[model samples]
Structures are given as C-alpha cells and as structure tokens.
Target chain A: MVAVDSHAYASRLRSWHPAEKAGLALATMFIALAAGSSLTEVTIAVLMLVMTVGLAGIPPGFYLRLLALPAVFVLVGAASAGLSVTGPGPGAGADFLVAVSLGNITTGFTAAGLSLATGLLLRSLAAVTCLYFLALTTPMVDVIWLLRRLRVPALLTELLELTYRYIFVLADLASQVRTAQSCRQGYASWSNSCRSLGGLINAVFRKAGWYSRQLAVALAARGYQGQLAVMEAEHGRCPTRAAWLAGLEAGLLVLAWLDRGHYLG
Target chain B: MAETVLLEAREIEFSYPDGTPALGGVSAGIIQGSRVAVLGPNGAGKTTFFLHLNGTLRPRRGEVRLAGERIRYDRAYLRELRRTVGIVFQDPDTQLFSANVAQDVSFGPVNMGLPPAEVREQVRQAMAATGVAHLQDRPTHSLSYGEKKRVALAGVLAMRPRVLICDEPLAFLDPQGQEELIELLEAESRRGTTVVIATHDVNLAYAWADQVLVMAAGKVIGTGRPQEVFQTAGIMQQAGLPTPWILEVYRELERQGWAAGGSPPRRKEELLALIRQAGC
Candidate 1:
C-alpha cells in the first residue's frame, strides 16, 4: 500500500481518542475470557468479531483471513488432544486393509480435550482480534502519545518514533535492492544469492547510518534538544459520549467477572 | 541597511571530519531583515554554509556572531543560537521525524520550552500559514512530496526564528509548487524575517531574492542585485548557472532593436509590461 493510504487510515484513527480504543480492547478480552462453555466461547468470539467489523469499518472477511493463518496451530493441538488416551494400552484395531492398519479405539474424546481446544481457539482469537482492533481503530501515534501522557521516558519515546520512521525507509530500500538483484540474475545461483545478499545488507546499513546522521543534524538545526513532546488531542472538551461508552464497557466487564465465579458470583 | 548587523561570519573556514575542505575563508555579514540568496552549483558548499548559520557546524578556524553576541563553545549558547536561527532542509523526510504532521511542527516550539498553550498556538499558526492545517493529523510518512515539503517549512516557522534559512527550497518542486513556495517566502520576508535561501535555480534567486551572493569553490565570487550578477557571463559559466529567464528575454528584446539596455526586469510582470510597451 502507498504511504498516503496508511496515513489516511492513521488520521481517521486519531480522530478518536486512545483511551476509548483501549477500553474496547480490554472489554473484548474480558468477555472472551469469561465465557464458560466451548459454545459460549465461540459465541463471544463471533460477537467480538462483529463488533470489530462494525466499529473499525473493516470487512469481516479480512479478520477471518488473518485468523485463518493462526488457526492451523489450534487445529494441530485439537487433533493431538483428541487422539490421546488416558489409559494408554495397545487397543484392538477396528479394520485392517491392504496391509494398512486402521483403528477406531475405545478412547472417546473427553470434555477436557474439547475444552482445551476451545480455550486455545478462543484465547488466540481474542488476542489477535483485540490487537487487530487496536491497529485498525487507533493510530500508532495516538498509542505513543498515550504512553507519553502516562509518563513514559522521553528517550524511549524518541527512540520509538525514530524506529517507526526508519523501519519504513529500510523496508523500502530492502525491496528495491531485492528487485535490482533479481534483475541481475543474482537469485538464480546460490553463490550469487549469498554475494548479493551480503552486498545489499552492507549497502542498506551504510545508507541507514548516513540517513540517521542527516536526521540528527536536521533536528539539531530546528532546535531539537533530545526531548519529544506528546501530541495533545482536542477531543472536544471531555467527550461525554465516549465516557458513557467507556462506562458501559466497564459495567459489562464487571458483570462478566461476577458471573464467572471469580469475583462475586 | 541597518546599523546593526544581526549575523556575522568572519573568515570562517571549515573542513569535513574526513579532512576535505568545504568552506575556505568565507566571510559575510547579514543585516537585519535582509533577504539574501546564496547561489551556487553542486558541491559549492551551499549546505555547509547554511549549517554554519545556526552553529550546527562550528568553524574550524574563524568565528560566528549572532545579535552582536559571539556563539561561545558552550552547549547552552549553541542551543540558543539554534533557537534563534531555524533551518529548513532540502528534503522534508530529513527534517520531519515525528509520527504526525502537527507533532512534527510542534517539535521545535516545544524544544524551545514554550508553554503548552503557546506551543499549540504556534503549531496551529504555522500549519495555517503553510496551508497544511488539514494535514495536521496525517502521518509524516504518508504525505505526498509537496505536502511533506510544506510541513517541513511549517516546522521551522513554528520556531518563530528571526532568521529563516532554506536549503534549495524549490529543488524538486513542480512549477506550481515553486510559485507557492516563492509566495510564501515573500510573505515571510515581508514579516521582517531575514530569509536566506541556498539554491542553484537562478530564476528563483532573481524573482525572490533582494540581494544575491554567488559562490564558487567555497568563496563568494560576486554579490549584488540579480541583474548586476547576471551581467557577468564568466561567473555564471564558472558556477554552471544560467541567467534568469526574464533577464534573457529582456536581452533578446534589446537584440531585436525593440528596446534599449537599461535595468533588467527581474519579475515576470515587469517583463510583460516592458513587452507591451515595445508593441510586441
């Protein structure tokens, strides 16, 4: 994607405040944790997914596509749990065909296995969805600004901002170098690939160092004194509606905690 | 000219850390509110000269004075000098490091220890003046080249420097962007800011600068009005620069026997008026 498109998304995200997005992310995680049954976890995960779709205005398919990549691990764990038995003796084979043994053992899939699989799926889904919502609904700058407001060290913030800026620059340079190398038949042979990779790494490092020096000099020219200031959001004099939504989310979290027998069931 | 010299560089000679000479025996005095253009070709040490203005680079041999006070080797004085003389680099990406545009613009004012409200006001005014108010929330990495350039200018304006130095301010801009920047520079100069631009574009120097200083091999070869400077073909050839287009057009008119040699027109409007008078 172009930088401008990412910037537009970031600008729209900044229009909302960071605290509100944090509240939503926390509420969804709590709800996903509170559900008891596998069915309940599934239902909560679906609801959270729907909420993200509605609030972030992203397509539901996009979330599903991202979740699919991590689902393979959950499936592996689930299959392994279903196949294991507690009593572990050689069980009778149900069928033998063409010198291949097939077995339907006496072992039944336990509620524990089902619950473990469901929990893994739900936890992974909730964590990924919460992070996705955070990225989609809040600009990274707002998150950094919130960190500064919470009194993060100025050096760390400055480092983070510089890291973010240079990461994109490095990524661009890497892609350009790779394209140029491929055009020169460097990737066709292993030795050529190694030499090309080494050259690219060295070039990128030298360019990054030069850019870093130039950035420092430019900053010094503009009176930079090693401190980065936080950006203050003009969030319309204490957004009453956002506060009400936050209160509602907090109330739901409390109710969920009580019903789960962890606090005051 | 003002009786008080706001900035003075006395026989300043500097070499890069690699021991390559960049500026050799350069001396210049900038009066308050003077719009000066340092014109030179590539590798003429134009950017190095600008770095010396704010003491980003200290002279290896000579001295620099601002507001009648020499910039001591102390860090505090260097900081004060930086706060007083703001520089806008040629590339906005180098100047803007903050995540968002407004934060980038506010960085200078905040570093200068302005109050929060005042910093906010400065950001707004700078953005407004540069016509980048709408881009305040946008990330610096996401802006188009033109918008990024404007935001960099806004960043410097937020510092409210008495002297504004731009390095090749119109280097990669299209004609429209160039015109807009020229207008912006003119407006800032009218506000009593001493504007110095280092550029190879003789046309911009002619149209925007009140006084031009031609540099070749780290030395000021000629300093005068644009017409007077352009009159010397030898210097222009040496610097790998051409005379301004308007000046060339006026010369062509004189060659056609349509007009007599006099003061050359520096602005397009002046050339238009001359052409109309010549019945062309």
Candidate 2:
C-alpha cells in the first residue's frame, strides 16, 4: 500500500488550483484569530487536523510522529509554569500554598500566566495545523504556477524551478560521493573522513561546473534564449472541483467565525 | 577530382581552465558524406575534439572550420553552426532533462522558433524515427537506459542536423543493443547524414566506420580506411587498441598456411565466407 503522508499529499495536490487554496487558507487563519478563546482555537485546530487526516488519507500515526518534534516546547513551557512559581521558596512555601488560588479566579499571577500560556499554545497549534494542511495538500509546482499567475515575475519562477532541479542533482551526487568514499575505506579514521569530505566537496563542485557547461552546450544546441517557456495544460477556466472545494472552505470559515462569536450559545 | 572537405581542424590545441591539456596539436578533416570514427582510450581528448565540431569549445590556437567557414565565437553564428551539427552526448542522463519524452524531443525545434504545428510535426517524426512515440508521455526519469539513449537521439534528430556527432554511442549497451545501434547509424549514414562517432570499441570501429582516425596522448596517430588503419601495428600499439578480431583470425589462418589472399576480409560476413572457402 502507498504510504499516505505529506509527500503523497503534495503530489496529489498538484492538480488543484493554488490561488483558491491559498485564499481559503488565509481566510481560515483570519477566522481562527478573531475567535480569541483557547477553547475555540483548539477545537478548530483539532477539526482541521482531522479533516486533513481524512482527506489526505494519511494515518493518524503520521501526524503523531511530527508532533514529537514540537512536544519538546510544550514540555518546557509546562515544566516552567509548574516549577518557576514566583511566590516563595519551597518549605518557606507553606503559607504561599495556602494563600495561592489555582482555579480560574483571574487575580493571581499564576492563573494569568497559565491562561496566557494556554492561549499561546492554542494559537500556535491552530496556525501551524492550518499551514500544515496547506503544505500537505499543495504541490510545489502549483505554488510556482500560482506565483506566475499572480505576477510574481518570470525570473523568480525560473530560478525556483532550476533550484529544485539542482537540489535533486546535488543530493544524488552527494550520495554517490559518500558511497565511493566508503568503498575506498576512507571513512575508517577521523583524518580520512576529513580528507574524504574535502575530496567529495571538490568533486561535487567540479561535477556541478561540468554539468553547467554541458547544460549550456545543450541549451545552445536547442537554441535557448535564457527564458523558460512551459507548456500548460489546456483546461478551460476553473474546474468544477475547485469551486466545490472553495465553497466548502468558505462554509467552514463562516462556521468557525460564528463559533468564535459565541452565536451558537 | 579530390573530394571537398566538409569539416576541417588545423593544428588545434586546447586546455582546461585548470591547466589540464586536453587536446594538443591535432589536425584532421572530414570529407563530405564520409563516416569517420574517432578511436581513443579514456581521457584521450576524443570528447574535447568532438566539442569543437560545433564550436562548443574554441581552440586556444589553430582553427576549426565547418563547410569552409571558420567557426566564430559570435552568438548568432554559433547558433547557425549548432543547427548544422548536432551532438549526442555520451550520457543520456545529461542529455535528456525534460520532464516528459515529447518535451525533451521537441526542445530543439521549439528553441529554434519553429511554429507550433511544425514543432509538433518535427517531434512526431523524430519520435517515430527513434521508435519512442509510445513513450512520449512517459517521464524521462522513468525510462530505461536504452530508452533514454533513444530519447536523447530523438532530441538531436529533431534539429534535422546535416552532421550527427555521437560520443561513445555504444559505451554501455549490451551486444544486441550495440548491434542495433550500429545498424541504425549505418542506416542514418545511408540517408546522407554525415556520422562521426567517438568510441573505444575497435570492433565497432572496424565493422561500422568507413574511415577511422586513431588518437593517442592528444595526437592523431593514424587515419585511413578501417581495415588499413587496423593493419598498422605501430599505430595500434600507440593508440593502445587491439587489432580487430577478424584481422586476428586472418593472421592465424595465414600462419597455418590455410589462407592465401591479398588482404583479409574486414566485414564479418565476408570473413565467414572466406573461412568457408578455406575449409576451416
């Protein structure tokens, strides 16, 4: 079975309209901010995450794995809140413990700090989840095409495309260099590692230079004039699927906005 | 009457920017409609010489002339020269860089500013010629090595060049694939496209090339018809190339006193016929 993840999402999303998706994502963020409560933001974040998991066909474990990286920040904040109470030292803290009001009374610094932390966590999670959905569902090509459509200049798009190509080429060359070094037993010692790494870098630079020259020759042979012209597909206007997705996104935005206003209660 | 030369290089010398001398004092000429093979070992400047054909590289000294016109460094003139002489690189991976096969093949014609319809026609014709029409929609990264080589060839053929310079066209092919390539090149030559190949395979040179130019240490050691060139023991030793297999068999037969002839057959079928006639 194909592993459903961010890469798969990106590939499938290549067929989508980037402008509409970007607009919807922007709308979702605005709605999330206007809904200032931690409860509202957390609810929206969870909903968005669930929708992404379902629509992208990604397993829940995929997202759980990503959460491991961000969990470090959460642990630090929670621990600081618990241990760094500014009142008095422990064992001189009997009076402080009796005097402290921990519930949502809103007077004590501890309660205010907890609320602020909760708000910050919810906001971050909501914003990150929304952006993650955007990244997961959008292909890099669609982003480039949308940039072109939005009049982001031709040179930038060309550079981006070439940069993508060169990255893959460099990655392949690095792997090849590593394999060659390993085969030659150059990684057996620290000095050998340093020498091998230096040699690899030199080789990579030389190969890249040679490749650029060859590219120039190939381009000249093909009569290239520095500008890249892409062959776009011949589909008329926006497809029906895009309109449906846009309407769904608008509906979700309105619902989130209303929930933030407490209109349902 | 002597045949007029289509391309000529006189005392050409070249060195890389790092001061590595690639080619030194090389002089050769290709006559119109002749199939020439450049034979050399690795790092012997065969590819560097091929790059000079269409002015991809300029000689530090001497001159390279095509169709009696000296190759210039001017951009417009270089484009015109490239239109006439197409190069197929040794590595198809470097040559075929487009996302799809059709786009890769159409690149040359489109870059030449052909009309859309004409470019499509050129691409179709090239794909048909190279037997890659079915692969037009396939991604270049997904193609097999042989298919990628064919796609690269089609990319060059779309330019409709009068001369096709192939660098090690059979380097990585199996025996059958090599035979297929030899036949394809022979057919292209018959269609009046001057074919110049740089290769390390002596047997391929003997079987396919009308004329062979052997190089050693950045110098042209010998140039003649393939049979005559292979017979020169000193030239073969200098080029670090073995004599052709058919020539070896002819020598063995001669030593055993079973064959008497003016010269041994260079062609494989002719060699078989001669052996049959000699009853061995």
Candidate 3:
C-alpha cells in the first residue's frame, strides 16, 4: 500500500489533470460492464493493465502480483459457477458433456454454466484493473481535489484528506511502540509477549487522544478556522489528450460489439 | 532610551486547571529585534510564559502587552495577534497537519486570507529560507526528523510574523541541524523579527542571544546581556543551569596570569582569539 502511494506521487503522468484520468477509467469500466462480452472485458482488462504498468510507471511484476490477488477469488467463484449437480435424476445432456460421479452425486460442467463463469471472471478482472489504473496513477491529493471540484461537501473532502494523512501517522506510531517494546525484551517470553502486546494496544489508544490534543493546539496556532482552506492543486486540461482517450474507448467498444460471439470451449 | 518593548508581561501569575503552579509573578520584557533566549531547567515555566506572550494562554493575575497595547481576546484581534507573533512548537509531528510540505507551509498564509499567488510566493520563500525548497513535493511522513523540523519552521516562517517564538527549539536536533537552525534564527533576527527561544543549552544562549533571561520557580531570576546574566553564579545555580563553557574558560584565563584584559567572551571563537592575542 505504501509503495502504491509513493508510486502515485512519483508517477510520470502526475501533473496531468486528474479529472481526465478518472473520467477515462470510469468510462472504460462502465462500457466493459454494459457490453458483457468476454472479448470486451479482456480488452478493458488488458488496456488497464498496460496503462497502469507501462504508462503509470508501476513495475510490471508488482502490478501482476496485485492482479493475481483478485485472480484467486475469481477462480474460486468461476469454478463454483461452472459446476452443476444433477443428482442421478437427470442424465447428462448435450450441453453437459463433461461429468463426474461420486456415489449418488453427479457433478457436470454445462455450456451455460461455463459461459456464465467466464463472463463473471472476465468482468470482475476488468473492473479491478480499471480501478487500479485510476488509483495507481492519480494521487489521493488530486482525487480529493477532484472530489471538491465535483461539489463534494467540504466536510467530506476534509475528512478524506485528514484520514489519509493519519493512516501513516498511526502506522508510524505503531512501529515506534513495537520498537520500544522489543528493546526492553518485552517479547522475550510467551507471557511477556502477551502482556506487552496488551500494553501496546492500550498505549496506542491513549496516544491517539494525546496526539489529537497536540494537533488541536498546533492547528489553533496556525489560525485554522472552521474549515481547512488549502491551496488547490492545479492541472491544466488538455483537449487533445481527452479526445484521444475518448477515441480509444469508442473504438474498443465498437470492436467488441462487432466481435460478439457464443461458444463453449 | 531603552529599546522598545515588543512583548511584555507584568507580574504574571498562572496555574494549571488542577491548581499546579506553573508561573508565580513572572515578569519580563522582550525588546524589538533582539535575539533573546529564555533559559532554565524543567518546570521553570518557560513554556507557560511563552504561551502568555501570544495570548495562547491568558495570565490569571497579570496582563500581556504587545508594543504598549494590551492583547485582546476577541476573535479578530487574536487572529491579528497570532499573525504578528507566530510560534513553531517543538514537536514537528504535532505541528504539521498537511500530508505534503508545500501545503503545510501554505496553511498560515492561507488562513491570513492572502491571494492565491501571494500564498504561493510565501510558501516558496519560506521553503527556500528553511532549505526545504527541494523537499516541497515530498510527503510529510517520508521526511527525516531534521527535515520535518525544518518543514515545521517553514510553516511558521511563511506567515512572516514580526516576532517568532520557539519553545525548546534545539531539542532532538543533531549538531549540524542545531548549527543550521541557529544560523536561520540569527538571520531572522537580522531581518528585524524579535526571536525568542527557550532552551536548556547555555552554550547556544550565550553565543547567539543579544539578551538572556533566566527563569527559576516561575520567576525571572536574571535578565540582561548574556555576559552579565551568566556571570551571576547564584542565579545560575537557582535556575538549575551551568555557566557556559566559553564564559568559564574565559574567566579561568582571566583569573590566571595568562589572560590579558578584555571583555568576557560569550563564544568559543572569541575566547580562542583572546588566547591567541595573550600568547597562550
């Protein structure tokens, strides 16, 4: 997660307008979902994969590893979808060519089931990839700015920004506490480790309250009003680039429409 | 005439909500454009006294004045007071709220309601002054401790306050970081901003401050030029502070026949020069 955040900050396309990137990703994802063709899903997934890895400068291996995480879930879901139990009552049909029988239970793979599984797997992978493309390229700061531009309430946007900032703060505090505990041989024995773990949790809870008070003092010193008014990140919109992305999405959808088919292999 | 009093507290008394005495009839005047250091041991009310200076904490029995005007507690006047007297707390983690350095530095100027371009310029200038210009784009969490301190200083500096107060500014700093910060504070003083710092390091106070104020048990035990204030052995002991090395060495040299007659040195370089002149 930390690596993904740093990569977004270091992304070569970071200066590009955030709205354009988010818009393009959202449009492609919706198109793939509505089209429902396996080929269209493949195109969306592949397109997002290349953009995230090649364009966004995230390492290809890392991107694939993240993609593989979803693959596990999709595989289990698709496997279940493809399986049908026709308990000895109905014989295998032409569509259900592959069958396995264990005692009275007969499990068979049917054409309709396989197709549904394929569609599910492809659609999910495409959606995950599209979201990853957006997250890996555009920074959370820009996304928050985009939210503000889209008329999100100041309260919600400020909360999003503050929450993102605190995630690292809490993680850093946790590591510090862990380090302190280990230095004192707090984890040397089983009972000691259990006691130390309990103390660490308690300290973190107390520290959260203490740190918030400190933050309040600092904020008051800075003349913080009811709202956190910060400088908005500026990104010039490029008409030609937006047009190009639109063209690419339209072309992919057209090709998917022309190439729709039905087959069980 | 005496230097114009930039900030003053007259017979101030304060106690924590639990009735712990933090200040007891403390009084001190900070002169305009003076590089001053408030020195004492722990629980000497250095922080409590500082809070009163900017009206962050009001005095229970006394009053604080800025340039002969009593500090007002109304929202608009308090905002003006903070704009004139900006403070950078010792802990950078508590002080820095933004995820990025540039945004954090812009917070003060933005609160002042400056134009966008002016805020940008202030942030840029503050980053440059603190030598964090290159790290402007870096995440606040990614910075080293020294870098974070500089970023925090930049955040306060961006406001361009007439008076800059730093509580225990040198705590948790490496020697190099300390030197750089001293130089930065000195430069700020040269720019006509009254720089008030609280510290335990007598050496830093001796070398850098035009005037020194020593506190003990919530009262001003000594206040004068560093040479005069540090020479008072009784005050130093009461305040739980040792005489600075330069002063000690210089006096030792003077006590022996090896030293020639001269003003006491507050810094090592000056002592060394005197030793060289005396053929020691």
- Name the candidate that leads on lDDT: 3
* Number of the candidate with higher TM-score, 1 or 3: 3
* Docking band of candidate 1: medium
lDDT of each prediction vs. the true structure?
0.77, 0.74, 0.86
TM-score of chain B of each: 0.94, 0.96, 0.97
lDDT of 3 by residue, A140-174 (tens): 87888899999999999888877788778788888
Model 2 scores a C-alpha lDDT of 0.74
Error of 1 at B173 (Å): 1.4
DockQ value of candidate 3: 0.67
Models, CA RMSD each: 4.3, 5.4, 2.3
Candidate 2 docking quality: incorrect, acceptable, medium or high: acceptable
Task: At residue A122, give the lDDT of candidate 3.
Answer: 84
Residue pairs that clash (backbone atoms under 3 angstroms), model 2: none
Please identify model 2 stretches exceeding 4 Å from their true place: A1-142, A189-195, A229-238, A261-265, B1-4, B16-21, B32-34, B92-106, B124-151, B172-191, B257-267
